[model samples]
Target: MDIQHVCILGAGTLGTRIAFQSALSGFQVKVYDIHEKSFELSKKMIEKIAKSLVSSQIYTAEDIQLALNRLSYTLNDQEAVNQADIISESVTEDIEIKRKVWTRMGEIAPEKTIFTTNTSYLLPSSLASFTGRPEKFCAFHFHDVFYSRVVDIMPHPGTNMELIPILQDFGRRLNQVPVYVRKENHGYIFNAMLLSFLGAAGKLLVNQVATIEDIDLSWKVNFHVPMGPFAILDQIGLDTAWHVTHQLPDANSQAFAALLKTYIDTGKLGEKTGEGFYKYTSK
Candidate 1:
């Protein structure tokens, strides 16, 4: 599919970042959010990121303008997708919500438009059937682009083999290293490895084996990494971590979910809300 235009659904954290990166990559990027307020937030977020890129000397003001010129935003679903060659969705982590969105998108988007989800836990095959075009559906998982430049591409049993290389090329255009997952894995490669680290650290905190600060310090001191599991969770956001934990169906997982819920219920969502496992002064 000569992948030129890319439509991104949901203007939240990852969606906004993807929109910016796609535009910077020279793809005509269309960002769609369900609400007007979300469009406002996304615009501001993209502006802040662009400014940061300039301040860091990674890009010039002209480069930022070029990216902005290539990007568009809309509230209408069908209008946002229209004739886009690829539609990347970064909505909530719930399966039902994803299925509903895919179903509607399948009914509206062009038949040639490839569909991909940014789901962290759900397998692509589980929701591919809802899209009505399983051969064109797959999982395209990305970390916070500012921190990680790798994206995991996982195809369902029904996906077309020919499309894999195209998507890989698309990832490269966005300046990302794309890893192909050989089979259907719940968390793909990175998240599968990440869960174990987060679970162990969560157990220590939950069982009072160590303080959050001390545990983070222990890992940082030993590993010489800037952040620990708790710090990573804060960056990923507690609400998002909570959803991912719920995907694990175990007593230990339930405990961790509850722990995250405690923070979320108090309106401390993470960096976005200024607090989570710890406090943050910057967004």
Candidate 2:
């Protein structure tokens, strides 16, 4: 891959940030989504974020404009993706749907384009199986602040040796601290540790061993964790957290999943819906 034009195939939170960061790094980036509403939303979000970056002194006015100039949006998959040297798929977390998108994307893009999925759970090998060029495909993980220094790059055994450096450099240019995880497992590195911790906290809550406040303080002050499990789950979207945990098999035996179905069944979708383990607002 020549590594210039970049296509982000979703306009959700993470996708928007990825496109913005790529554009800021001087790459011609196009962000596309099946939903026109999301296309519009991401556009506004990115523009506002760019201005914030400028106001916050993260970038100069010229730098912000340059980033904006490199960005475009569309729903036509081929138009947005055909010429891209790198394609990032940030669709919802469903293996079947992801398989469908990757199949279509592989068919439309240039042969050497590096295809990647911003999947939080699915293994890299599983995703690679769906693409036309598995050798050039990988998993690129971004945390809550998708534009942050934390990043994980997971490549399958079949991934191309030549393309790895391009991705590493891409992470570096964007000020991302990238770590490569060789094997595939549910949750990769961060999520594996995160889900386990959340389980323990959930157990404490369910068992009444401690109040949410106590559980929160124990980790937040004692371990200096930025946010406690409940708060983190709130931001991550309760419905999403509930569903992923259920798939863990042993997750239902833990404190987290005991009330998982209850939270989701009751229409408490965490911060996105203004209620979950904590109350929230649309702000």
Compare the candidates by lDDT and give the number of the best one: 1
Cα lDDT tens digits for candidate 1, 99-161: 999999999999789999999889999999998899999899888776598999999999998
Q: After superposition, how far is residue 208 of candidate 1 from its true place, in Å?
A: 1.1
How high a TM-score does candidate 1 get?
0.96
Report how far residue 68 has shifted in candidate 2, in Å.
Answer: 2.1
Off by over 4 Å in 2: 145-147, 251-258, 261-268, 272-276, 281-283
Model 1, C-alpha of 235: deviation from truth (Å): 1.3
lDDT of 2: 0.80
Supply candidate 1's per-residue lDDT for 264: 87
Q: Per-candidate TM vs. native?
A: 0.96, 0.87
> Candidate 1, after superposition: displacement of residue 212 in Å?
1.4
lDDT per residue as tens, model 2, 110-226: 876888888888887887977878998988877754344677888888988676788888877767888888776778788888877888888778878999878888889987777
- Residue-level lDDT for 40 in candidate 1: 83
Which 10 consecutive positions of candidate 1 have the poorest summed lDDT? 274-283
